[model samples]
Target chain A: MSVKIEVGAGGIPHNRILIYGLVGSLVLIYLTYLNTYFQTEYFAFFGGLAAVAALIWGTDTIKHLCSYGLGTGVPSAGMIALGSGVIAALFGATTGIFAPIVTIVIAAIIGAVAGIMANHVVRMDIPVMIVSLIELAIVGAMTVLGLAAMACGTFEFLGMITGTVSFLGFTVQTYETSVIGGSIIAVIFMLGAIAIQHSFNACLGPGEQQDRTLMLAAECGFLSMIPVAIISFAFIGTYAALVALVISIVGWFYTYRKYIVLSKRDAYAWLDAKPILEPKGGA
Target chain B: MEEIVFGIGITALAGALATVAGAAEDTESDIGSQGDPNSQVQLAPQMGYIHRIFNKAVAGEPPAYGLWVALGAGLAWAFMAMQINPILAIVLGSALAVFVQGVYATTAYLGRTASLAKFGQPVYIDILKSMTTVTMAHAFVAIFTTVAMCHLIISALGHPFPLPLLGLVWGIALGAAGSATGNPFYGKERQYQEQKFGAGVPISASGNIVRYAEAGQRNSLDNGFFSAKLGGPASGICFGLIVFFELWRTVVFEELNIWGPIVVGVVVILIFAIIDRYIEVWARKNFGPYTAPEEASS
Candidate 1:
């Protein structure tokens, strides 16, 4: 019976923010399905926004789970979440209209089993580990699904593996896209894992606050979107990928500036280092 | 029906291979002191505890393996497309991947240690020369087996996703399993053996890893010996079960409809959740609280 450690809070409860993240991400990602109707990949940038939301939710779960003295489990938790997520996301993509909902169910199941094994077998004894794991897994799935949608313009497994190219609004060529073949999915996996995990790893301590951490999470998400948006050029086309890149840069800038402000506010004193006067003694 | 049976066979084979890969991955990570616990190794030097632990964390195991396996599988896939022999391509691909792993390990070890030079930590070239090969060797086995498993899933089982994608997914899963399941055994049981067993790491002792061995000062190599006994195999079983159950659910239930596996998966998760709850209660009853009654109440 280890005592659970509590993370500090800002104005809002983490759970409420978590709901915002979950619902916001799911809704935005589901919007990408509109591409099926529009016959264009213009809505793909919404997937990047969805990833940002999922990453925010994931960051909170990690903070909550690691608050229980998980020592070094922070990054591991992130990887595990994304890892299990890839499995669930792939499986879910096989389903037609039910991809998003099915992804949640499968990811939850995988996360639950992994969480159980961690508690009962590994015996970390963290009270919130199971629920946190389940949430992280879903977040991870959404991150993967979101990024894949951003890159491939669709989360369908077949859609990911195949693509068509048009020149100046004229049909030109149909070819196999490299989302899966060239291992762009691998890029998405690492990007999402790092973006989701790096937030807490970078900003954890006794003085850590939720608003600051969540701000960083949002920033990390947008930073991650840069690469995905670039990759989206091959899959989603020039104009759609350009829109994603523009949105990613704008979102990233806003969050980054907000994060810096939050950091300065929480900090006791902020100082810039003076330039080194030439070393007094030679090496 | 035959396809289902064949999927079962492939899943079994993949599971067995995942078991081996999982063990090797954890062992290699333990040898390198790479992951959450690596932070402790980094902090030890700053705390004036200069030790010879091989601190080579290029990234966490999951993403690292994801990169390696994906690279290997991608190259192999390209070679296969070029009409090369599959077995030869796999070997070549894995060898190249292992080389990349070796480079990352060497550079990370050197770079981190050099940064700790301000703390009077010595750069032990011998440890670097010796441990890099050991980690890379284990990494080769893990990477090879994982890429092979991905290949089997793609070619034999006819998984729609290409080899690189499967490699990425399973590689991450393999790393996750090892990190979650095996690392605590190394981090808590082996590294911090001075502490009582089953008592979780206290907040006060976050970066203070055990630096001494039974004989002399401890190193990551010694940690590997202890973790290989329990941690390695536990991770193996964890990963094997995950792969097996995941594929097993699909193979057995997907025929009913797309929802079949999802329904069954939900049921499986619910069952585990109940068991986990029971275990939590039992453990609490048996072990009692770490805090005093008054402290716990407060």
Candidate 2:
């Protein structure tokens, strides 16, 4: 009961592994499909490996410290899956280089809640399940966007569509007038998000302050990505990575501010938000 | 080369094993919750509260930093290998320069070279004492990685095996091995604030973030970054050069199979071991010297 909870924030073994494997596989497969469809051959080994390492770090840090409970695994898995989704989407973006800003921002938000949840949110099923399902949808959306990008060598709603390197690498015969692809992706994501959210709550259970914090952070993570996806368009040249990074930072700060406020507002406010290693009294 | 690998493997395995053993050694009854390590206390109110923000920021910094260090050490090893020198000189100098000094090297490089490098100071662990050493290490890794990456690209393109490129690859890989072996503890949010911000942030730090989170309590100010810091990057960088050039010999002069990376790997490991041993001696000599005098007086 007195064991320490850790928080570089990546745990929930079963679901997280599933989510990671799914996202990784999906991206790989989608890229493969696009490559085959367009007759190109490029490999993003570094990208894939980097994502895995990042995901592993998150899971190892967040989950290993988790104590036992009825369905605590939900949030654990949910948070990680959500994180994986964010990372995968960022990776899937044609402007993947700028993805970290979103990832970082979301990561902090998730991390805070994960930290708080590490204390409370014992029977976490609904949110965890919902986040897990969202990961798949996120990956799917990203894949669609990736496929579109692969098709036209441009991002969603961007004015100009270009061609893949044709004979050199993964070929997507994208020329101008491929606006439809990205929109379709948007539609799919919107439709899918609801189902995913439903499952998240299904996996999650009763109201604990810790649960609130974790859920809030996870929500912040998703919200963080919206800007990431939006700002990625303007990501250019040297400012590319930094811009993304800044966005992510903002997301994290936003999550923190929201949580701090939320925690303060709660009647059961434990101003001393230390982890309740004793499992039951956490949140 | 074989020796270096053996060294790192032995060190990492031993270190890992020792860590596990030490944890196992701690019984439920033997210690406290870090209050005294012998007495159980409630979630001590003394813990830091401004905890999550700093924690998140610091936690966020590492992957980028770690990746960069790993890659930088590799790249430096490769670049230094370009110059042939005393086996000792090359090995020791580069290892120190790359693995230990790599954070410094990257800080210097980024500060000088890239636009973002200018931001190097604030975010990067100061080789001297700043929050961004981890960041600096990672940046170096990235630079080295790009160099190695060029070779990989060329190799995939199937021109002649650019002999120089392998150096970059081996250098970065070995550097990671070196850095990982030297300072292996992963940090938490509380640690990040205490270590990184020094007195800059208003966040309070917890003795242990294991449980009971707090913020802005303002206990002691501990910006100390060197937990068990030593200079082994030099050894790592050198080993990378050695193994790389050694492999280059086979690549250019004769035909070898996968022995290139393997041999390089071995040398890298051995170099780390030797470096670790030397560092232990150095630390003992410097830090322990005072202890001996104090003990004598007692």
Candidate 3:
């Protein structure tokens, strides 16, 4: 189907945005880990924010790679990214060896190999395949780790494993927390997948622009935070839950407003002009 | 201007991070003053706002209704609260959500495109036809590989990788492999049609060359089963060998390093790749060229 929208002229290069997104996500994730380790009750709110940043980064990566037209649908690309990401994240978390670094490195390596296979072996013929896949993998790993950390309030090896087990409803034979916290990772993983994939899938067209797509990304990111906030309410304290709610609201409002402005600016001539043709006599 | 917007976003994020960090530090000092965790306030009202905003944003859009999203979230939470197996809850809940949304989006897209076709816009029916067939085949391969990976991880290694993680790993690996393999296999079968825009024309026009095209004649069920049949055993054996080697070295030889397993894994993958190459060649030679009944009669 033909897309009606027009691509915008020059704007910030996607690579630059991607770089900033990656740096920002990594910093936020590290800070979240620190905060969760140092301060327990307030980890949820900060960690949730970190997850939002990761979502933004991941969505931007999707927008970048998908613009090249992956022969395997956009959703498929997203699933691959998340799939590699979750595995790497679990391995790192479970193995107790520099979890974040390991996760990022492994995901990147796997993604790169997969990209090469797609290009040479499968012969998909997408030029930016390798770099894009690597970026997608790294960002996807960050997204999963960030969200999982937020859910469990820490990314430490023992805490993450125990959190995961608890979330799975398995008893440690010695319980610590009253509520199951690890199950929230499943929620975050699914929501993060949707947020990253939906922005580009929904906004794609001739008129697809970075600004509008980013706005949609922001919206999706905020929407995904709702479940995180609810989970925080049950596990974390009231203050953390309230903070999540507030951040989501403020973020949504800011992004939605920007979307309206960009949409208006990008509006077609027919959007404002009156219809010229009247209904036929048959009507 | 784009740089400026990105800069602003970064700044805003930094500011928020600082605020949260400060608050966390303060909360740490005042932990004794905090209220009971069980007496925490409900999140329904805030969640309701999120639902409303999401609904408004996705209004009239197929597959992403607020109700379904809310229901999915609720089911996940409820399942967890009830102490249901976390993996089962997530899989079922996510599956339900995705299915509901997929149906809605597909229906809407098809309905709108069909209407547009009446107005003279080309509706590529073959695109949809191929998608269904391809997705079914890929799903089978992916599921089989996942099961194989899970068995290898759990039964052999004594490490119980969670179902969710296993699902993601095998799902991605098999999905990518299928896309890589299926594209070339099918690309060889059909001739590419020129189109003005949007990827390529997905039409199935007659081509003069028909060598090895019979592969396309197989039904999706047959194709799916064939892929699973080849892929399942290959994955199982590869993983089994890797795990067995690792176990042998770690348990019997008292070697704790992972290099043995890594090397074994690589060797297994190489072996599988070679076997796959042979299978492809055999299939191409045996399937023969496609000949339409009409073409043969003419």
lDDT of each: 0.77, 0.31, 0.46
Lowest lDDT 10-mer window, candidate 1 chain A?
A274-283
Query: Model 1: which residue pairs collide?
Result: none
Model 3 CA lDDT for position B95 = 46
DockQ, Cα level, model 3: 0.05
Q: What DockQ class does candidate 1 belong to?
A: incorrect
TM-score against truth, every candidate: 0.56, 0.34, 0.50
Best by DockQ: 1
lDDT (tens digit, per residue) of candidate 3 on B118-174: 122222333334433343232222233233333334334444443333434433333
The model with the greater DockQ, 1 or 2, is 1
Tens-digit lDDT track of model 1 for A50-161: 9999999898889888887765566678889999999999899899778988999999999999989998999877799899999999999999999989988887878777
Fraction of real interface contacts that model 2 preserves = 0.00
Question: Model 2: per-residue lDDT, tens digit, B81-135?
Answer: 2232323322332233233222222222221111111111111112223223443
- Per-candidate RMSD, Å: 12.2, 16.8, 18.7
lDDT (tens digit, per residue) of candidate 2 on A1-283: 2233222223244555545644553444344233234543232121222232233322222232232232223233433444444344534343443433343344344444544453456433433433323333343333333323322233323422332223355444453112231122222122122212212222121222333334342333333233223222222222432443454456545654554344334322222333222213322
- Candidate 3 error regions (>4 Å): A1-9, A95-97, A163-183, A269-283, B1-75, B78-298
Please give the range of 10 consecutive residues that has the lowest summed lDDT in model 1 chain B. Answer: B289-298
- The residue-by-residue lDDT of candidate 1 on B78-159, one tens digit each, is 4554346988878777876676567557545654554344455555666777789999888888888888888887788677
Worst 10 residues of 2 chain A by lDDT: A198-207
